[model samples]
Each structure stands twice: as C-alpha cells, then as structure tokens.
Target: MALASLIMLVPVVLVTSFLSGIFGMAGGLLLLWFLFLVAPASTAIAVHGIIQMVSNGSRAWLSRRYLDLKILAIVSLGLLLAMGCLFAVQYSPNKAIALMVIGLLPLLLWIPASWLTFDASRPSHAFACGLISGALTVMVGSAGPLIDLFFIRTKLDRRVVIATKATIQVVAHFTKVVFYINAALMLDAMGWTTVALCIPAAFLGAWLGKFVLDRMSDLQFRSWTRMIVTCIGFAYFVQGTSAVLSA
Candidate 1:
C-alpha cells in the first residue's frame, strides 16, 4: 500500500505541474480534487498549503526582481487583516459561512468577466479580494480562484504579477497553516510525509509556471488565467460541498 501510495502521487505531480505550467499558479486545488477520495478534507488542505507555500515562496524569492513591491504590499496587508478576522471564527466551521462563501464562489467566478478587464489593475478591490481569499482558503481549502479573478483584471507585467501572486499566496497560506496547527487541524506524522512528497510536485509546477509566464502575452495570460480560475472554482465548489457533507 505504501508503495502504491507513492506511485499514485506520480500522476498527481504530473498533472499539477502540467496545468501550472500551462497556467501561472499552484495546481494544489486541482490536485486536491484528484486525491480527495483517498484523503480527509482537512488533511488534503493542509498538505496542499504546506507543499505550495514552500514551492511558491521559493519561486517568488528567485523571481523577486520582477515583483511589484507596491502591489504586493497592498494585497499582503489585506490578507493579513483578513487572517486576523478569520482568527475569531477560524476553528468553527459554521456550515453557514462555508455555504455562504461557497455559494458566492460561483457568482464571483463570473464577476471577473464584467468587473475584470485586461487593461485595468484594480487595487481598490484588492482588499476585498484578498479578504475573501484569506478567509475561505483556510476554512474551505481553496481560494486561488478568488485571488486570480482580480488578478486577471490587473494589467501588471506577467512576471511581476505571477511572481507577486505566488509570493502572496505563500504568505497567506503560511498564516493559515499556523491557524490550522493551533486549531488542531494540521497533518499527522504520516500526513507530514505525504505533504513532503507533494513538495517536489509543487516546486516543479511553480518553476514550470514561471517558464510559461515568460512566453505568454498579456491577452494570452488574461484568457488562460480566467479559464484556469473557472476550473479551480468548480473544483473548489465540488470539494467544498464534499467536505461539508463528509464533516
């Protein structure tokens, strides 16, 4: 079983790296959807966060010269504030909040179409977007789509945008990890092993994504990111409903 489990991770690594290469972010949510049948929801979320934080943090650090510090600061602070608010109800999984966020996720998926434009970098919505991404990411396990929606609207340089988002995501999810660990939602020893196994997949995915970022044009990025975000939202909605039901 252990051998087979390791083998199973092969496809997980491949698919995630491929998608993240073709797109521009972590494929954790997509990988989670594929693995949920074999793992608990919280375990999957924590492992996903841990693996990707290391992976994306490294990607961002190496790609720092391209990052827009001003935009990074704006969004990172909002996510932190959101984390503080999330602290109160962080441990509690009020079906109400999850449901509310889950319900709106679909709606928000379409919002970028109307509210998002290729030429605009809407930082005013950065706080609200980061807030939602921060809150539900820990609670329900996926918030990349929420963050990507506003990002698609922004016209920042692709390297700057992708690397910055990678950095912010790591920071945001790192804080959530502490919350989960404190709330006793973290991984066990074996779970930690599983998470460690996932690390290479995530790192490769981020590296491949940065390579893809170099080749993609702004219009190409906007179009492809929207599609990827839509897929992520759908993945989250399905997995989130399963989490609630399984809980």
Candidate 2:
C-alpha cells in the first residue's frame, strides 16, 4: 500500500467504528467505500473483513453480557455453510451486484416482520437469514443491515440487539477473512502494519459510540438506525446507478 493510503486508513476506521458502534450499523459500508477508493475490490473486501472483525469484536466484548448464544450459534453455522459453498464454487464477488444488494437490503425494514412466513424466534429461520447474509457479506463487504432486519422482528431491546448482532458479525467477518485469504483474493492488500495502527482507533471509536448508545432511548436508536441505513442505501444506489449509466 502507498504511504498516503495507509495514513488515510486511521481516521476512516475511527469514524466507521464510531458510526457502527452508535447505531449498530453503517461503519462497514463506510470503510468499504474508502477501501474501494484506495484499493482494488479484492483488497477492499479483504481489508474490510479484517477491520470489521476487530471493530465488531470490540463492540461485542463491550456488550458481551447481552449476547444471545442460541441465535449466534445458529447464524454462525449458516455462515460456515455459506463459506463452504463459496469455496466450492470459486466465486469472484461482483461489485455492481454487491452495491445493489447493499443498497436494497435496508428496504426490508419497510415490510412488517409479521408478513414473513417464517418465525424469527426459531433458530432454523435465523439460520436461513444467516445463509443469505453470510453470502451477501462476502460479496458486498457489509450486510449489517440484512442481519439487523432479522433481529428487528425479535423485538429485543436496543443494547441486546446491538450486542448480539455485533457478536454474530464477529463470526461472519472472520469467515470472510479466511475465505478471501484462502482464495488468494486478499493477498495484495493485507497490510498488517496499517491494520495494526487502525485497530486502536477503531476500538476508541467503538467506545465513544457505546457512550452515545447508552444515552439514547430505544425509540431514538431505532429511528436513527433506519435513517442512517436509508441514507447509506441511497448513496450506494446512486453509485451503482452512475456506474451503470457510464458503462
């Protein structure tokens, strides 16, 4: 990596971590955009996986008491299965498809959870959501919103929701890093030194975010999450549309 790119990574990760920590969303997508600007798609995806793993890990640890183990296990199993499928197929993630999927995932919130046939309370259904989410994460670099959709129906309080989701993401992102590295797709941009410098910044951001989260009411948290997700979706949608138009 160029010296400038490495230098730019710190502030980006710090801000991404704070945003993701506060709302339990959007940080990964922000990092992905920056990585795409500074690196190749594979590098962007791989680095995202690594940084997100650390960021989510910190958040998960901070809120470890509230984690739902059953859901975590079920979703993790699904993520592993999805990883195996990707490995078998030798897939290369499509950038346009990724952008479109990321853009559209938030729209799932507009649909009432009651409209879905499956029970969100069931582990099997959680697994199913995980299957889709895991696959999408590998392609898009951040499917946090999709995971959020699955949890919204469960009606957990804000802290538990954020904690459990962060824990699940730790597993999901780990899978991505392993898969991408094994496939030799992440080789060019695994800058360990750069990553090391960014880790503390990400952790600091998460801490600040948690402080903000503690002060917000459940209603406020949910409202902010939806608004943030919508804005991110529109941004990606525009980027994708522009790419298509130019092509």
Candidate 3:
C-alpha cells in the first residue's frame, strides 16, 4: 500500500465501527465512499462489504448476550439463499438506480413507507429473503436492513435485533466473499490497504456507537434508524445511477 493509503486505514476503521453500532448498515456506506475514492466501483462494494463484516462482527460478538436466535435463524436462512444466487441476481446497478432511490428518499422520509416485512415463522420464507439479500449484497454492500424490516414488526428487544442482524451480516458477508474470489476480486493490495485503514476506525466506531445506542430511548433509536437509512437511500441513488450513466 502507498504510505498515504496506509495512513488512511486508521480513520476508516474507527469511522466504520462507530457508524455500524447506531446504524447497522451505515458503515458500509461510509466505507463505500472511502473505497470509491481509492478504487473501482466493484472493488469498492466488495471491500466495503468485507469491512462491514469485521466491524459488525465485533459488535455482535461483544453483545452475544442479547442475540435473538429464532430471528437470526429466520433471517440468516434467507440471506444464505440469496447468497446462493449471487451471480444470477444481476441488474445494471448504474446511476439510474442511485438517482431513483435518492429521489424517493425525500418521500420515504416524509411518510416513512412501510417495510416489506419477512415472515420469521416460516423458514422457507426466511430463506427466500436471505437468498435475495445475499444475491443483492454482492452488488449492494448492505442488505441487512431489508431483512431487519421483516423482523422489525415483531417487537423484539432492540439489542437482540441488532445482534441478530450483525451476526447474519457476518455470515452473509463471508459467503459473498467467496463469490468475489470466484470472480477473481479478492484481497488486492488496495483492498487490503482499505481494510488495514478501515478496520480500526470501524472497530472504535461500532463499539462506541453500540454503547451510546444502548442508553438511548426507543424513540431515539427509531428516529436515528430512519435517518441513517435515509442517508443510505440518497447515497445509493446517487452512486449506482450516476456511475452507470457516467460509465
């Protein structure tokens, strides 16, 4: 890695870790932007996904006490199935996808559109969600929110929900990397450079964010959740569609 890039890793790790705690998927967005500055688009997504796995794994591991096993199982199966179809779930995620979502984010923020919830009671259905999440995850750095939307209505403890999502993300990210490997995109020098820089930032950020969120009221948590996802929608809409169009 270049010296400048190596220096960047420290902040990357801290920032990612911090964001993931409050927003399960926020770190991915931050990491994507950082990596986008340093690498190609596909590489940015793959590397950021890996960064999120590590950042979130730390939080989930520390908070294993709060994990909701049933919920995790349901969502995990769906993520796994989605992973199974990684190559087949392709769509041209160009600037158009990014712009469309960015445009919709304002409306989503105003009315808070309903989440397409998943049926946790049915393993088959859960697996279907997982399958789709996994596949899209390859193109999209994070899909845990889609899975979480499915579970959010269940009224589980907030900690348990967060833990389960983090755990499932770890598994799904790991599986997705295998696809990157098969597609020959694993651990390039720049990728490792990003990892080295991002891991510490992510580690610190995620840990601290979790502690802060733990003390927050449910209303605050819900508000922050919407805020973070809104940011992501704008980010994706700008990124995917713009890049594709520009390409």
CA lDDT for candidate 3: 0.64
lDDT of 2 by residue, 70-171 (tens): 888888889889988987998787676667777888887667656864433588888987898888877777788888788766677788888988988888
For candidate 3, the clash count comes to 36
Pairs with backbone N, CA or C atoms under 3 Å apart (clashes), candidate 1: none
lDDT of 1 at 71: 64
The stretch of ten residues in a row with the least summed lDDT in candidate 3 is 101-110
Model 1 spans > 4 angstroms off:
1-7, 94-109, 112-123, 182-188, 235-247
TM-score of each: 0.78, 0.92, 0.79
- Model 1, 1-247: lDDT tens digits are 1446545765576567556554545465566455444555555555556766766676787588988676677777777877788787646444334433543464454663555542214566766767767877777666766676667666577777667777778877786676666432443566556566767766676677666677878888767766665666565566557656787
The models' CA-based lDDT, in order, is 0.63, 0.81, 0.64
- Best-performing candidate as measured by TM-score: 2
Error of 2 at 154 (Å): 2.0
Looking at model 2, report the run of 10 residues with the lowest lDDT sum: 182-191
Clashes of each: 0, 0, 36
- Order the candidates by lDDT, highest first: 2, 3, 1
- The best-first sequence of candidates by TM-score reads 2, 3, 1
